[model samples]
Structure formats: structure tokens, C-alpha cells
Target: MPAPTSDLASFAIALAEELPGSWTTEHHTHAQYPDQFDRAQHVWDMNLVAHAIAEHVLGQDAALTRDDGTRLYVVARPRHGEEFLIGAIAPSGIPAEAFRTVREPDGIAVPDDPVQAAADITVDLLPRYDKALAQVHDNAARLATTPAPELVVITLTGRDFHVSKPERADAVQVLLANGCVFDKDQGAFVLPGGDTAAQSEAIQNTAAQLSRLGVGLTVQPSRTTPALDTAPATAPPRTTAPAARTR
Candidate 1:
């Protein structure tokens, strides 16, 4: 189907979902009658019917059509409290008075106006999206200030654990979540002596989280390995655009 027609179909379905009452699509066939109508003529007649339905029943300015030259119609019965009944003019070569009543599927009630319905759905989903974004930002910030592996060393004399040059936000969130604290004077994440098991577990958890976020960890040289000059890296600043207001 042409892109515009496809888009119209999508729009119709979305609109239908929001409107009150049930909706159904019907295609009229004239094959049963012996009088063979010209295809072009039939399409023209159907277009007229579609326009009438859109204007009188749907209260819309224009009719929506498909790529196959089929006229689209939305048939609905407005509920008890509704001002007007919703129904469609079938393309069965019959008069609009001969319109048939189709069953409406159960659906959520929506506002009478299509634009208002769309706005309602947008309002409902925004808070969830904002919460997820906030979480991502927090995680990113934590990773940026974390210490590197080479800097994570235990001094033999004091048994003080140190983490150096931690740069990834995700990594830092994992460490912080797993009970690691920063030491300003030592310039590292310090885990006091006698908690080797807990320290190891924290490191392992940080590695797992970093892997999930697609961030690579820098391995720093410890007492056993030669220390490399690893520089601390900062996460890029993030900015969020304000949500557009509904007028």
C-alpha cells in the first residue's frame, strides 16, 4: 500500500481505539447482482458514500480511503449517555437508510474528541518514560566517578582496599549498590581489612552490571601486577528537553 494510505489506516485504527462504542470494517460486494457495474463507477459511488458517512455520522471534515480504492467507514453506536449514535453507511449499493448494525468489541472508553483522546494517551505514558530516563541518568553518573581496577589495591601494612581512576558511570552504580564507599583522603573506594569475600563479591557484581550496560572496565595494576598510568574519565553531560505543553 502507498505510505499515505497506510498512515491513514493506522490513524483510523488509533482513533477508533480512543472513541466510545464498538467499531468494525465492512466491504460491500456487488457480485451477487446480475447488473455488472463499471469498477471506476463503483469506486466513485463508494467515495460518495464514505464522504457522507464521515460528515454526517463521524462529524469529520474528510473521508479516509485505502490503496485498493476501497472507501473506509467507521460504524459505531454511541453509548447511553452519548449525544449521537455512531454508524457507518455500507457500500452495498443500497441507500444509507439500509445501513446494518454491526457488533462492537469491548474496549476502553475514550473522550468524544479524537485530538483529546490522543492527548489523554500521551499523558498516561509520560510519567513511566520519565522515570526510566531518570534511572539511566543516575546510573551513568555513578559510573563516571568509579575507581579503576589497578587502583583497587590492598595495602599490605594497613590492609586498606583502594580503587583508582574509576571512570564509567555504570561501574560506579554497581559498586555503590553493592556497598562500596569512596575515601577522599585515600582517593579510592576503601573496603577495610577482613572483608575479602565481600570486597570480591562487590567487584564481581560491578563487572556484571558494566557488562550488561556495554561498558568496558579498565584493569589497573595491583601489587602483583605493574601499575599503569590510568587516567580518570568523566561521563558526558546529559540534557533533557522539556515536555511540550498541550494547548
Candidate 2:
């Protein structure tokens, strides 16, 4: 029912498809950076990503929130397989263990080798995660250059849906078995740890919880907060930060 904070990949996909006007880009800041691989550069890059998502995906003064009181916000980067930090938002703000979490403390029964057990734990799932990571990469590419004004991060924030990608779907199944929270909205597994059913249940429970949080189902007004700097008139509106650009 609340907005998704951990669902950055969705935002990235949306940004790639939406956003408007020409925008600039830069790097992120890092901690130990006297050179190109410096942390400062990383931080700078992340900021640019945040800007891109804010301007391109969400559009002007647009954002979404669900009912369970889960809040979603726009940011520059959502954690993915380290390709481009091209700005995004996630709906975390679902903790790692928000859904069903399984602990491997007793240790999974498998060959004594740690590598084998770990591999066995996800022998069928590695490919899925890899593919999902790849999709995220593709999404990053699209968001960087998309030129649309009405950006909307499309995602199914509920249960009973399936990832179209085979590998990703497999990984979701595996991760669910491993106690990871595979958020349908976020796509990335909430490995605190996530898996398939957790992912499914997150959406279902979220919808159910959000139902009663509404003010008689009349639609709440936007919470104009987060912006703080002078920006382009067309820039996404922000309360304490810039709002993602949308219609």
C-alpha cells in the first residue's frame, strides 16, 4: 500500500522510458579517492543518477505511495550488479526481512564442500540472478538516454505475479527458499534474505495492509516535501529533495 523505496530498478526502467529535455551528467563522490577509482567519483556519479531519475522518470512533482504505510521515494541509485549508478529509487524504507526469511544456520545438507553447498544452494538460481542483473544493465542503458516527459516506473507491487525472465524467475524461487525477500516492486532480492513466496507475499500483504490506511479511499494529496535548491522550472518538484519528473 505504501510507495516502494527499494524498487530502484523499476524506477530505472521507467526513467529509461520517460523523462524529458536534455540533461547533464557527472560522477559520484567516494571516500578514498585521489584518482579515478576514488569514492568521491562514485558519490558524484550516484548524485547524477538521482538527478536523472528525479527529472526523467518521476516527472514534475510526481511520486507514489502505497497504503501499508510503506513509503517509496526517488533516489539516484538502487543497488544492482555494479554497472551504471544511473539514478533510481527503491521501496525499502520493506526491511530486508519484511517478508519470509530463512536462516541457513543449521547449514543446508549437501556435499561437505562450502563451495559445493553454496553452489548447490543456488545451482539452479545463479543463472536467474545473473539474467536479472543483465536486465538491470539494459534498463540502465535505456534510462540514461530516454527522452520522454511522462515517466512512470511500472511494476507489480503485489503477489501472484511472475518475472517474465526465466533466469530471474528461477532465482526468485531459489532465493525464496533461501530466506531472501524478492520484492516484485524492487526486483532485486531483499536478501535479509528473500525468495519467491516472500516476494509474492510482500505484494499481497502490502496491498491488504494499505487498504485500511487510506482516508476512506478518496486519494490523499501529494506530500510536497524534500526539495531545497533552485532548479529548472521544468525540473521535478521536490519538498526536501527534487521530485521525480512525470506528468
* Cα lDDT over the full model 1: 0.33
Which lDDT tens digits does candidate 2 get at residues 92-186? 22211111111101112222222332344344322333343344445445544753221111122111222221133333354355344456685
What TM-scores do the predictions have? 0.25, 0.20
Error of 1 at 113 (Å): 88
Least accurate 10 contiguous residues by lDDT in model 1: 97-106
Worst lDDT run of 10 residues, candidate 2, spans 214-223
